[model samples]
Target: MTDSITISVDAMGGDHAPRAVIHGADLALRERKNIRFIFHGRKEQIDPLLDEFPKLKPASTVRHCEAVIAMDEKPSQALRKGKNVSSMWMAIQAVKDGEADVAISGGNTGALMAMATFCLRPMEGISRPGIAAIWPTLRSDIIVLDMGATIGADARQLVDYAILGSALARSLFDAESPTVGLLNVGTEEVKGLDYIKEAGKILQQASGAGFTYHGFVEGDDIGKGTVDVVVTEGFVGNIALKTAEGTARQVASYLRTALKANWVSMLGAFFASSALNALRRKMDPRTVNGGVFMGLNGIVIKSHGGTDEVGYKSALGLAYEMARSRLIDKIGDTMQRFPVNTAPPELPSDSEAKSA
Candidate 1:
């Protein structure tokens, strides 16, 4: 933690490109000063932006990369066209090259994941990596994982996600032992898919895994802050994420329509304008903006490509915290403690067979 933590920034990956990304890095430095940036993108596009932030310029290094991955490009196409030359690929490569502690990209989700997996690979003993996100809840923020990194996790993969999510919660919340839950259809004992139930059993039996198992939680419990970490497969996790996002926008739209309905309503809205503004800020998805690809050898945080400076800044802050936490090592050091029942039965070794 003493040494300056280097964060590789994909300066040209987002809709706003070097502008929003550099502005975000500058704003983030206000909150955290120990960060050193290695920005990957066209020097012509990035240098001008860095010059505006004199404080950040001295603390940053820029690496020129001519190619940029388009938002519409498929992961395969992105890799094929850019390889290690794209801004996104080069930024992720910094992590694998040991030049950066972590990489942050406001780029195509599939491409970022693809490049990250190709460059850094997964940590030893990890079959597939999961993406963990910070979710705002009624009581406190919670952590949810496998938000479309890899879909259809088996019992063991689900359990690995729980471990990764728990470590994240601890890093963010400073919780000594965060409570973990399996997201399910219902809270009843016999309510979920076999894999979920099996993962729950494994979590229950894993005393050394360093988290409190809170058992099954329904979708309703997510916003209620029922647990510090919620574990689910990517398919369900991604659906829940989109549903929450859409619900947020729907509620906001409904409120706006109500406020402008009539003279009396408009007057009421005017009087309560301050409170409404605070509510707006709270509900803004930009406040919680990073999806961390966990269970990898190094951290890779995916920022919303369409977000503005505020949202990108949040992502940078998240990357800083994760790098400070050394999350990869923590997850790697603890993963061996929990093994799921769904793991295929092991075959006897030749020596054991002969002895038998």
Candidate 2:
């Protein structure tokens, strides 16, 4: 933690590339002077932006990369065209090369995941790496994993995610034994798919090995922050994330409409502006921006491509906290305490299934 943390950034990956990314880094540096940046992107586009932030320019080292991965590109196509050359690829490469403590990108999700896996590879004993996101809940923030990194995990893979996520909870929340839960159809033992129930059974048996298993949690439990970490396969987790985001937006829209409906409502809103502002900040998805691609040898943060500089800055802050916490090492240590071999019968490895 004493040493400066180096963050490798894909400067040209986001919708507001170079500008948003560079500004975000600068803002992050203002708060945490111990950070250094290695920006990968077109020299022409990035250099001028860096020049605008004198402080950031001094702390940053830019590596010019001509190619950029389009936001809409397919994972396979992005890999074929961008591997070894794209800004996104180069940023992640910095982590693998030990030049950066972590890599951050506001790029294509699938491409970012693919490049990270192809370049950094999975950590030892991990079958598939998953993306973990910080979710703001009614009570407190919780960690949710498989944020669409790899879809459809087996029971053992789900257990792996629980360990990976609890490690993150430990790093971020400083919880000695973070509560972990399986996201399922219902709270009952036999309520979910066979694999989910199986995963729950293993977690119940292994409670206190590293984390406290909180049994099964339904979708409502997520917003309630019923557990410190919620474990699920990518497919369900991704849908849940999108749904929550959409609901937040919908609620905000409803509030705005109600406030503008009449003079009385508008006056009430003005009277409660401070409280409303606090609520807005709490509900903002941008405030919790980065998705940590866990189960990898190195840390990789994926930011929302359409986010502004403030949102990107939030992502950078997440990267800094994760690096400071030694998240990857924590995951490794937690995995040892909670072995997957002791779990239910294993399914074919994700890679083998993909290849077939």
Clashes of 1: 0
Judge candidate 1 against the unseen true structure and give its global Cα lDDT, from 0 to 1: 0.87
Q: Any runs in candidate 1 off by more than 4 Å, and if so which?
A: 336-356
Q: What digit string (tens of lDDT, one per residue) describes model 2 on residues 131-169? A: 998998888999998888887888889888998999999
Tens digit per residue, CA lDDT, model 1, 120-204: 8877767788988899999899999889999797887887788888878877888868899999999988998998888777777
Q: Which ten residues in a row have the lowest lDDT in candidate 1?
A: 340-349
For every model shown, the clashing-pair count is: 0, 0
TM-score of 1: 0.93
User: Which candidate gets the maximum lDDT versus the true structure?
Assistant: 2
Query: Top TM-score: which candidate number?
Result: 2
